[model samples]
Target chain A: MIIAIPVEQKDPDACVSSTFGRSGYFLLFDSQTNDFHFLESTFATGQSAGIRAAQLMIDNHVGVLITNRCGENAMRLLSAGNIQVYQTIAGSARDNLERCLAGTLSRL
Target chain B: MKIAVLSGKGGTGKTFVSVNLAYIQDHAAYVDCDVEVPNGHLFLPMDRASFEPVDVMIPSVQTDRCNGCRACVDFCAFHALGYAGGQVIVFDNLCHNCGGCRLLCPQKAIIEHPYNIGSIRTGNFEHVHVVSGSLNPGQMQGSAIIRRMIAQTRPFPNQILDCSPGNSCHVVQGILEADMCILVTEPTVFGANDMRICIELLKLYNKPFGIVINKSLDTRNYIKTFCREQHIKVLAEIPLQPELAVLNANGQLAAKQPEYRRIFQKMLKNAHSLVAPQNL
Candidate 1:
């Protein structure tokens, strides 16, 4: 399963971004392979940035999305794609992902 | 003569001056272009007999003809279109209706459809024809509504366009086609700053304009000094009166009073003289 986490930067140690749409980078982690890749958001500057960000998760074949907050439109699109979105507390990207894996984070 | 009353900031009395001007002048049309919150109807007695919807062309994709190459998605600058699950999806909210997607679609799958975003109402109030546009709540295409409003408006001998407050695209749309612009401002630091920005915009467009000082209290003449320094005319000044404020808040035309009637008449005369000569 591939998980997409909105992060402040491409680095795993970077803080989890507060915004799901305008985040600097989305870290896509494959739990099965234990590998990760950075997916740059095309909607870095757009009106429906959150919706486009959710579409990015769909295009990347992500099964889960980890973020601080998700807008109504983004949540609708993400849910339509059958991608589960989890809300995490303020922490580094690696820490949030670890909590998400342990099933401690709440589903958005 | 088409005169646009505008301001860079809200609560600067653009509507206050505009609605009154239309009421006092003969054969004048009051066009409220502030579609977001068209409160001009409150002050004027609308006939409610004439109204029309403002619609814009939104793109639609023919699924069978689409190859799902994501070309149209990449072409949309507003991010209104996206490609996922081997299909292209359209977000109507973000669509500017620029027709770029339809023009750039390699597979010839995109088509245009009309989407109503607002309504324009026309009525007779106090012997003056009143036309106003009201945008639907949560709609983002304000400029499109203004454009549709202008297209439907019949040119009269005198027209007063009550523009939305702010230095946005919608305000520019209202100002661009006008023969003259009246920037309504108050006597405050923020008012002066915003008025200066508006002045810069007018100068950039090379459009002729004047100033109307509204709600002038016993404060210093900062607005007068700024206009003088910029070589702009102070068309009229409506003194701050508590009774006038009370009347305005209750949607009553302050021009009903003899004093305000004289003020609006003088303003109309001044604006006509400022705009008429250039046309000659």
Candidate 2:
């Protein structure tokens, strides 16, 4: 399973981005392999950035998304993809991902 | 000839000028391109002639025909189309109705559907033919209605387009169709600053425009000085009259007063000469 967290930087300690669609980068963590990778967000230029960001997550096979807020359009798209979006925990990507993995984060 | 009445700032009396000018002009058609809040109709004594819904194309996916190709999803710049879980979803609000998704769909699953955004109302406001486009509440697509409003103009020698405030795409749509523009502005610092942007935009578009100082209060001339410095003509100046506001609030044509009638008539003649000097 892949867990995606919107972050400002590629570092695991980077603070979780408050915005889901216009986030600078997305950190993807693979639960089985315990590996992580970063992908630059492509929806920054358009008004539909949120929808495009959700598509990016869907294409990358991200099973779960963690962010501060998600727009209604993006939320509907992600939910239709069978991806669970969770509100971020109190701190960085590392902390949020830990809470996500522990199944303690609130589902958005 | 089409004359557009515009202002970069709101509450500059663009509608007031447009409606009165249309009423004063002989055999003219008045088009209210301010779809967001079309108040021109309120000032006109118009009976509802016709109402037509204005619709824009929004991409709708035929789920059965979609093959999980994800082509449409990728083609949409607005990310309006989403493909996931072997299904496609169209986010109506995010969709710009560009029709790119439908055009690029390899499976032919994407179809363009009409989404009604607003309506156009046309009627006779006494002698002048009036047309106004009004967008539905909460609708963000004012440009679509403006385009429709311009297209719905009656064939007349003189057409007055009452443009919405600001320099947004909605205002540009109306400005583009006019032969000349009458920039109605107030004599104030904020109005001057906002008018500067509009002046720049008109210059960029290569559209010739004149200024109309509405509600001129103080004897000092700030708008006049700016116009002179910019080499733009002041077509007319409407004095600050409490009676005019009272008349306007009651949907009365203040231009009916002989003095204002002469002012608007002069404005019409000036605007005509600027638009078509050959005809003058």
Candidate 3:
């Protein structure tokens, strides 16, 4: 499964963004391949940023999303795409990713 | 002459001034462009009002023919469309009804339909024709309704557009149809600050505008100082009287009273001189 987390920076050690929709970057971690990459959020400043950001995750085939918060419109789109959303703890993307893999993170 | 009355802050008496201005005119059209919560109709009671639904084109996709092309999904700038489960989903609230998605669909799967978001009510109140735009609850297309109402009232010789507050898109729609604008403001720090923003908007649009100081007190205030420094004419000063408040609260036009008639008449005269050349 591809797990996505809204991150403040490109690095895995970067802190998770408090906002799900307007985050600067998203860290995509693939559990099967043990590979990960950063995708820049292009819709951060535009209207309906949450819906566009959620569309980005859907287009990227992200199966799980870990974030601090989500909006109603974005949440609806994520659910329609069958992407599971999980709440992120107060830590770096790497730390959250570990907790996610260990099945300790709570669903949002 | 079409005059738009706007205020950056609410309760500065946009409707109060609009209804009274229309009341004093021999024949004028009063347009309530504040679709969200229109109150101008309350002050100007009309007889035998006619209503028409305001509709906008909303696009829907025929998924059987869509073929997961993603053309419509990518074309929507409002993010109202999304591709999921090998189909396109339309979020009605997010849609701005731009109609680009239907035209851009390669498979011809998208079709446009007229969706009613609001209605416009028109009636006659003595010499004045009253037109009020009311948006449906939870609808986000007040600007569209305002545009429709303005188009219908174009042939009228004189018009007073009661614009919604705060320099939003609704205000823009109302201001775009006016020959000049009257900014209603109060004598407070917050009121003056908001009036400054409205002044910038008028300057950007190159619309000739003057100020009306509502609820004025005996002492000099921020709005008076700001208007003096900016060289903006103070078209009228409505006194802060308890009687005026009582009349307004009772949905009465202050101009109907002998004491307040002169104030609106002077305001109309001043507004005319300010825009006479351009209007002619």
Candidate 4:
């Protein structure tokens, strides 16, 4: 099962890699192979799925979503599409995923 | 021409630009679609000529026809309708108005009816129509009233939709329908970051937009550099003028000032150049 992880910057401006047009993250996680590939979501999307976010999820057939804190509407939408949303996992994408797979993170 | 001033984040002066722009335009309609907290009415004094109520349709299932099969609960993708044993509960706030449960129910117990989610205040402001949409405090679906407010405009009128914060349905609803979206942003990391989210949604909707840097903190290198690399047009730059902010706080439109009238006029001109120029 491939999963999608939503990410945000602790402070984008402080980061040096031009957070201008860059996205947070819509990472692709291969559960079977344990390989992680990320797709960027458009900036300021926060947790909402914009065009790129939806497109990436649809194109990649993401079955699960991991995020820090997602909006209620977004959680419902993703859940409706059978995408399991794991929320309230604090920290970076890698840390959250580890927690999610370990079955120790709380979901909103 | 419908112009939406939006940002992915809050406090970037979306309503500020919207109120002043509408004031300067004179004949235009200004709609504060930020139903959760519509502040546009603060800057522009309205005459309260007329006001109307807006309602949204929500599903209300009749228990008599419910077979206790839990069919409605199973069909509801939003978990809005839930059944534990026999009794079914409808969480109105979670309902998205998608009408999926009603269609899927075999007993036909799910009936749709209008729910009063908000009210709209319509008034004349110096020849401009000032409209404010206020959502019911506990209601979650404020975007429906926003759309209704947009639909109530006069024929071929230049309108400015002062959108809400974030990329929720409210923001997208404003951005998707507007002719041109004038993104109100600041030069901060959070501002530009939020603007970038707005830009993605606009691009997704295939709408053209320009950036309006508001409340410039005398440092705009990051935002300008980002816009430069993205090939986006940087529109009028409104510096962090505390005088304008104070004036706005006191329910005054900056466009009322003789010195800044030209800026609003030019913004109107720029807005006219975007999609739906005929509306301008």
| Colliding pairs, model 3 | none
1 versus 4: better lDDT goes to: 1
lDDT tens per residue, model 4, B75-152: 765556644324566668767788888888889988999877779998887778888989878777787888888888
Question: Model 1: runs farther than 4 Å from truth?
Answer: A9-11, A37-46, A58-61, A79-82, B276-280
The runs of at least 3 residues in candidate 3 whose Cα sits more than 4 Å from the true structure, single-residue gaps closed, are A9-15, A89-95, A104-106, B67-69, B277-280
Interface RMSD, all candidates in order, equals 2.1, 1.1, 0.9, 10.8
Chain B structural similarity (TM-score) per candidate: 0.94, 0.92, 0.96, 0.93
Which of candidates 1 and 3 is the stronger one according to DockQ? 3
Candidate 1 CA-lDDT value: 0.85
- CA lDDT, candidate 4, residue B175: 79
Can you write out model 1's per-residue Cα lDDT over B64-171, one digit (the tens) per residue? Answer: 999988888877877778765566777786688899899898999999999988888888886888888888887788888787767666568787889988888888
Clashes of 2: 0
**In candidate 2 chain B, where is summed lDDT lowest over 10 consecutive residues?**
B271-280
lDDT of 4 by residue, A1-108 (tens): 887665444331112222211346556779899877656554343422332243345447777766555554444445545666666343566766677788886665
Candidate 3 docking band = medium
Q: Which candidate gets the maximum lDDT versus the true structure?
A: 3
Error of 3 at B188 (Å): 1.7
Per lDDT, what order, best first?
3, 2, 1, 4
- Estimate, for each residue in B1-280, the C-alpha lDDT of model 2 and write its tens digit: 7888999999999999999999897898999888888888888857867988888988777888888887777777655677878898877756667787777888998778789888988899889999889988866677888877677674687889999899987889878888899999999888998898999999988987999999997697789998888789889989898988999899899888898899999988777667656532
The CAPRI class of candidate 4 is: incorrect
At residue B276, candidate 3 shows an lDDT of 63
Q: Going through the candidates in order, state the TM-score of chain A alone for each one.
A: 0.96, 0.96, 0.99, 0.66
- TM-score, every prediction: 0.91, 0.89, 0.91, 0.70
